[model samples]
Target: MRLSRPLRALVVVDGTDLHHDLLGASSALRDIVLEGGVVADRAVGADRFVDPLPVTAEADVYVLYRSSTHLAPEQQAALSAAVAAGKGLVVLHSSNLFGFEEGGIDADQVAYELVGSRYVSHGDAGSEGTYTVRVRGGHPVTAHMADFVIEDEYYVIECRDDVTVLADRTTPEGGTQPIVYVREHGEGRVVYVALGHDMRAWGSPHFRQVVRQAVLWAGGVGLDAVASWSTRFPLGNGRFIGPDGGAPA
Candidate 1:
């Protein structure tokens, strides 16, 4: 089964919108080509999960949405192990929604240890309205034009010392917070983007690119594959080795 393609992916969402997208019509068609993993949910989990929340090793890539970032010990161990074994992760909306500090559980313990960030307080970002998404680097995904605007929510996340931020927004109070971040824990890579609270924001070309880029990059695919794969695996946090080549699955 593995040889038929290469990688398996699961996109998990823990809110309403994310679930709608993952289980929608567009996503099924998209999965035909890319063929990875998927677990995009739009619900709120009262507690962390212990097993593979999305699927299993069958999925090498994960696209998380609107769920708590903290993982149950079992869940964290599984995901971390997958990545350490060479899996990929792509997060949207609230990979940071975890409230482990407030509600302690097995998953909370795993999450607290994994994320290492504690939530202290939250204040309004004061709605910057629709702003431009600028690429800080020359990655092909975002190299298209320059910057594009989208109606998005700028969240205030409490972070840890080891958190590596990719891009951030200027807070009204004169501080910067990362809207997108990627970190390597053990062997797996965590790519989290704080966008998608506003559904309309997905309209921007750059917005889609950011998501597509993060997904493909995590699974180790390239830009040229985006257009084709986008259609083939719309509902995914899905994966396919593409024409290139990923792990042996």
Candidate 2:
């Protein structure tokens, strides 16, 4: 369905110490939202660390892609409250590594609960390899998605059973692991994607499709709405173009 107005998304990508290309990932995320016909505003580094509470209130959906900076308890509570109050949340990749601490002290349990999963491990050292993302039928986010291959960290996560699994991958140990899922929090929606390790995943058309659909779905856009809009205006090449038909700033 075509929205009467564009949804506002606040994309946050910051970490004290990160091994992944967070800045590049953040740019890709912003582009995905924009191409999906949503308005995106990014918060990076120190800008995100300052007064995180107020920022949550301004956007309809919050997209997070951070690896290592810990949020304060109150900050975590604010995020949980925001989602509970009907704001959407899209968590990507290493953002699941939120609550763990070396000695289990000062863990951000609220954030972990909000995400509905925690990163357990990626298996072994050379585990980062090519794998297929198998789409499970019957979800708006994976409506017309096809299984695609990507080279990334095979994330092993401990997830809540309540979340609906939309897509998954097979582990080397002959097991299945969820690569994408969704859940509801109060009046809001939450989506978690285990891909996007780097450009390898980001460059995939299937990955872009999932992220775009996830953002729209989380923002309360129904399947029919998205299908209608996408049919009329396909996101060609997944590039962000301004209203004037030129590249955006």
Candidate 3:
């Protein structure tokens, strides 16, 4: 359904001494969401880990890119409660790297369950290379998207059986690996994208398109409304201009 007002998004990019470029990733994501006519705000570093805002109070949707080693129990609970109350969640990249044994954290069960998957490994030699991403048809997140190739660190994760895989890649061993997927938790909707390792993946127009649509879908915007918005503000070469012919507000 069309939203009566602009969708508010809380983009969290928090981590300590992380290998991934959190700042760059968050910047790219913010631009993508804003281009889709949504208002985006960021929570970075200590602000997110030490003192976090109430998840439900901050925005209608939560975009997470946390590569940290741990998430506090209270914070995890808050996020769980928010999503259960119908707030949307969009998890990206290493945000799924959480659990007790797998995540190296004390209390991450709630967060782990929320993400619906736990990162296991990429592959031998770090599995960083160019590969094709096949977008699965018939899903809102994969609408109008075609298979594309990208240079990234392909992740291997163990997921719950209930998630619907939207896109995937073939492993060197000729096995199917999920690249994008969605889940439903309580009254909230969740979307997880396994791409976005760094600027190389984010620079891809296809990657940006998937993420933009995922954010919109999680925020409860209907396909027709999303199409209308895309028609008005087409994302060309990752740059989007407002209707007034200036930067997006």
Candidate 4:
């Protein structure tokens, strides 16, 4: 039988550095991707997970929104195992700071490897500059998204060679920085978006849409399939309706 719900996603805001509201960000993600149920969790520090990262009943997608410089070795291992088992991994803004610390790669190497991007730094903390983000190509996640201007922290990331570039933002210094990307890992997928700095991004329709599509794509669902389904259902509300013409539980 087909599953009633689209898929399960776990949002982890383990270590935010208190730069952003972890709860609020998680809630925003939940609202953005309601088609796939989401459960938000946090970790007190590098060693303590409030929700105790699931092992057996792992969700289809795991979102790392933490800003911590480190994660417990066990926690890192658990995430690695999940991805190896073919579960999707989503890395958000500050999560890129998980490694490449002050001295060297002194943090969660597993997460860094999975995400394929390292957070070098950002311009500023306040709403000073506007970032003109552009979609790189016709990828499933960026299929329906267009160039958008957002007032948020513009990140400078050190990206990998093999990752597929999904979006980019050109800095004022005449350098282009990747804002979004995706790549395959083991038997799973990985997505990284460097836009979410605070509520400004979370509240934007464009950001929300990109996040929604990324979640579905990470979970191994295609936006084309979702778009086709939405067209047939004609909800007017951007939501999912099972072929039976009822919302999935």
- The lDDT per prediction is 0.51, 0.77, 0.76, 0.68
> Per-residue lDDT tens digits of candidate 4, residues 94-207?
887755555366556776687787888775443347868877646777764557788778788888787998889877778788988999888888989988877888876667
TM-score, per-candidate, Cα-based: 0.65, 0.86, 0.85, 0.80
C-alpha displacement of 179 in model 4, angstroms? 0.5
Task: List the lowest-lDDT window of 10 residues for candidate 4.
Answer: 229-238
Candidate 4 Cα errors over 4 Å, as ranges: 1-5, 35-56, 100-103, 123-128, 229-235, 238-249
- Over 1-249, each residue of candidate 3 has an lDDT whose tens digit, in order, gives 235677899788877535888888788888877777788887774244335556437688888987876677777877787788888899998888776455463467787788788788987646689999987877677775667788988799888887999999888888888999999999999999998888998877677777878888888887776554542334433333222333442
- Over all chains combined, what TM-score does candidate 4 have? 0.80
| Clash pairs detected, candidate 3 | none
Report the C-alpha lDDT of model 2 over 1-249, residue by residue, as the tens digit.
347667889898867535888778888889878867888888874244336556546789988888774666666777788789898999999887754665342376777778888888887635599988888867888765557688888899889878899999988888988999999998889999999888888877677778888988999888886654432223643333212333322
lDDT of 1 by residue, 1-249 (tens): 122235555545443443335343234313322332323323233223334444443565666554334444566665555666677776665555555544654445555445444333344656435554544654433333244456776567776667666666666687776666666667666676766654465554445556656666677665555444442223243433233222122
> Root-mean-square deviation of each candidate, in angstroms?
8.0, 5.7, 5.2, 5.7
- Decide which is better by lDDT, 2 or 3: 2
Backbone clash count for every predicted candidate, in the order shown: 38, 2, 0, 0
